[model samples]
Structures are given as structure tokens and as C-alpha cells.
Target: MDLMIANQKSLRNLTVLIIGAGPAGLSAAIQLERYGIDYIIIEKNKAGGLLLNAEKVVNYPGFPHGVKGTELAKLFTSQVQIRKIIKDEVIKTGYREKYFETRTKLSNYKSEYLIIASGTNPRNTNVIINKSAEKKVYYDVINLSHHKGKTFAISGSGDAAFDYALTLSKYNKVIIYNRADKIKCLKKLYDRALQDNNIKYVKNISVLKAFASGNGLALTLSNNNRIVVSYFVIAAGREPALDFINSDKELENLIKSNRLCIIGDVVNGIYRQVSIAAGQGIKAAMEIYYQLNKENN
Candidate 1:
């Protein structure tokens, strides 16, 4: 059994393979469970995806007073406990005859259908703090949430930037710098942020350099301005988390057949919301069910 599992040719008789455990992938699993579909969901890192980084989620239905991002993630995770999510990374993917093959660090698996719910990764930036001060910068606030009376310099002008500002303001001062003069975040996040005296927004500036400054970090701006802060947060932007995927012509054509479904934040662009992602997952599962049932009959 071990030898057969180790062999990449040994296939798992699963109907569909989902590559993420975020809201979209989790919802797909929940729906597929109801339909009794033989499916496997794999997640490389945390099961919650971007929501794990959120400080507070106000828009998700059910929580009257709003819920923390991590809390929502926990709730999403609870619903999918019936099946285990493969906690492994998919290094490569390809289609094998009629099966979709995915190679992970430990093993490989193939299925009749594939769902790419890998979601989005932070946008790459030319600006990288040196290794000496690497720990002083972060993409999320999980580590810095407990620190009090410290200043944080956030780089971005979107909802995430303001969201990070609001999260950090609980016990620290936050300075947000935007490359352009206009703000891209919703008016509510901006307005609510203004109510907090700890948050400050600076427009028309870019982080040119960042290095170690005492026990913190020193940032040089595009206009030759500089600021020293306890930590730096990057809320710049995000792009599809499809770097590991190859642009195969055959795979691209599979979308038309619904055999390869790409759902959630990875394809949602600016509309990356939990509810929307869940809805897309349900829609994909419904279409998949119809196709599978038609074939079985």
C-alpha cells in the first residue's frame, strides 16, 4: 500500500480535487459532501487563506457585532471537519489522460475534475527590507497585535491598508502612506479610521528604502522623507496565486468544459469577499454535480 501510494501513477478514485481550503474551497467541499462526491481538498498553509490576516470582519453575515478574521476562519474550518484537508503544497500540476494530476511534496494525486481555489498572494514589490531587519516587517498583524505604544508604517492605499491601520490602532499609532493622492479603500473604512486618533494617512509618498533603526525600522520615502517605526506593514496589493501553475493550452481549454474550475479570490480581482467566494464555490459545485450525474446516468 505504501509503495502504491508513493508511485505517482497510482491514482485516487476521487471525482474532484480542490486545491485550497479557503472560504471558496471549503464551501465547495461542504456542498460536495451533501452531494456525496468523492473529493479531496488540499491546502498548503493555513486553511483560512486571506481571512486569517484580517483583524475584524464586519460584513460577513451572522455576526451581529462583527467577528474577528481569525474567528471567521475557525468557523469556516469547523464546517469542513468531516473530511481532512491535505496539508501539503502542490508544486506542479498537469493533466494525465482524463485525470488532473497534482504533484505535492509528499505525493501525487489525480482526479476527474480540478478546482483551483488557491486564492491570491500579495503583489510582488521591488522594495525588500534587508535580512538584518526582516523580522521588523510583515504582511499581517498577527505578531504585532499585542505590542503597545509603538508606531507602524503601512504602505498602500487600499482597503487592506486602512484595515491594517484600524487593527494596529488598538494599542499603537499607525501611519499610512499612499503612492498616489487618492485613496482606494471604501469610504467606511476611511471614515471609521479617522475616528481613531492613533491612525494617520499620508498621501503621495512611496517607500524608497527600509533598514534597521535601533530596535525597529527606518523607512526612506520617495520625496526624500524618512520615518522610523517599530514595524512596517505591506498592504500594497494582491495578484492571483497561480505562480505554481503552468499555462498549458490544454488546461486553458478545460475551463469551457467546467472540468477545470477556477473560483474565489484568485479570479475575483477587486471583488475578493468571503461571501462572494462562497457563492462562487456553490455555483461551481452545482454545475459539477449536474455534469457528474449526467455522466453517471
Candidate 2:
């Protein structure tokens, strides 16, 4: 789009610059629009982030039949367009005095306040494997329909692991392998998964390596055992994507000062759900407005 950089003095009229146009970022954008505040949203990838990879989202509001992850993302983008907000991605951000300078690959912009909703990045195991086998390992299992009737293996001990296993079991023979002896997911979910005939639970099993074998994959277990599967899903967890901005003391302190404000996945009461991210977005926007108004008065 447009990549023009306005004079620094012109930014005095702007209130906030939101980074990452995911659910949370867009939610904040909507709230800012309602408050009549001048703000812009910047995203590195497309607007939806990880949610775009989801196969189907049933927990989100309003849609009873459930909506595809990509479609839901489109709805969010449509909302942003209807509100007519500025959107771009921040390639580099720096703090100067009380203002923040944000530069994308093509343009530079400045803002009085910055909301970092960069979200989290999926965590992956460091096990070395063939390139083709590595390609089959997925961080998120939102869309398992593509692998119907396939033999799938998941490595994780949390709710997400169980959730993925349960969801994929409906169409595939699913197996969950964890490094620990006990399952750490919610008791209810763990109990439910125990009842599934299609799901095989294997604990204290670590994947030492994996390789492509014909149409599927062959994984070598740490215990010298081997298992062959059509796909591998790594539900290990995720870490906040704050590596880019964490080096700045001022920005880091701003995040710490605002008790409710968070930089990534560790934010209180926040989950790995699209709805929760959207809620955080709205909360951050309102908090920014409150702080700005308080300072003005």
C-alpha cells in the first residue's frame, strides 16, 4: 500500500500504534475507532496470525456451525475495513523521548503510544530429522480433516495436546507421546481421552529423530523403539514473540508498569484462543484511551 512517512510533528495528532493485526490487534483497533482516537495497525504477515491456520473454530461466538479459521480472519479484516483504519507492519521500532518511531520495510511512522500485541510463536522440538519429515510436523492442529484416516502422532502433555488428539481422533488413528509418565492436561479432558478407542497414549516416550518413509513418517523413539505415522503434530507450547522489542528498557518497563498489559503468551487470563486474543485487544485499546485521557486532564 502507501508507504509515505509524514513529518514527525504530524504524529502529534495520532494516539496509538498497534503492532500485529491478529485478533487482539484488530479488537483494539475496533475499540479505538469507537473512541474516535487516531491509531493504526501493523502486521508482519497477513492479519490473522496463527488463527488463519486453524481448520475450524467452534468455540468462537455467533457461529453455531463453526467457521473455518481463514474465513473468520476474513470477517475480522472486513470489520477493520468498514472502520477505515490505517494498517501496516512494523519492521523496526525505536523509542525517542516520549514517542515511539516505527519503521516498516517501506515506510516510517511515529506514535505517542504503542500497543504490542505481537502474540506468541509456536514452540518446536529440537530433534533433527529429514527435511520432508520435518515438514509434516505441525505446531497447530486446527485443521486435521486434511489428514483423515491417517496415522498421526502428537507430542505434548498439556490441554492443547489432548485437544488436538481428541479432535484428530474423529478422523484419524491418533497417538500421543509425552516425555513424562503422567498426563498434565485438564482432568476432565484427560479422562475423556482415556475413553477414546482410536487414541493411543504413550508416556515417557521421547522422539529422538524422524524420517520420511514412503507416504508417511518413521520416528525413532528415545527408548530405541520406532513408530511409523502419516504425520507428526508438535503441541509442545509457545513463547511470546517479543524478542524484537524486549531489548528496549523503556518499552519493557511500559509493559511491566501496566499490570494488565502483557507482551506475549504469559499475559494473565489470556489463552491460545482467538476470542481471548480479541478480548485482550479491546482491553489494551481501552487502557490506552484511559491513560491518554488521564494525562490530558
User: Over 4 Å off in model 1, which ranges?
Assistant: 1-6, 9-13
- The sequence of per-residue lDDT tens digits that candidate 2 reaches over residues 1-297 is 112345765443346877777788778888888888887777766677766765468789999998977799888877775333444555666666666776776567677777777877777576667887877877776545556789998888987788777778888898999999987777977887889999989999978788998888999898999989988888787877765454546655766554124432435324678888888888887888888788889
Tens-digit per-residue lDDT, 1-117, candidate 1: 011234655556678999999999999988888888888888988888888878788888888888998899888888776456888998777775677777778767877888999
CA RMSD (A), model 1: 3.4
lDDT of the candidates, in the order given? 0.85, 0.74
Using all chains and alpha carbons, the TM-scores for the candidates as numbered come to 0.90, 0.76
Show where candidate 2 strays beyond 4 Å. 1-14, 45-79, 82-90, 105-107, 142-145, 252-266, 269-279, 294-297
Please report, as a residue range, the 10-residue window in candidate 1 with the lowest summed lDDT.
1-10
Error of 1 at 18 (Å): 1.2
Clashing pairs in 1: none
Query: With candidate 1 superimposed using the best TM-score fit, by how many Å does residue 223's alpha carbon deviate from the native?
Result: 3.4
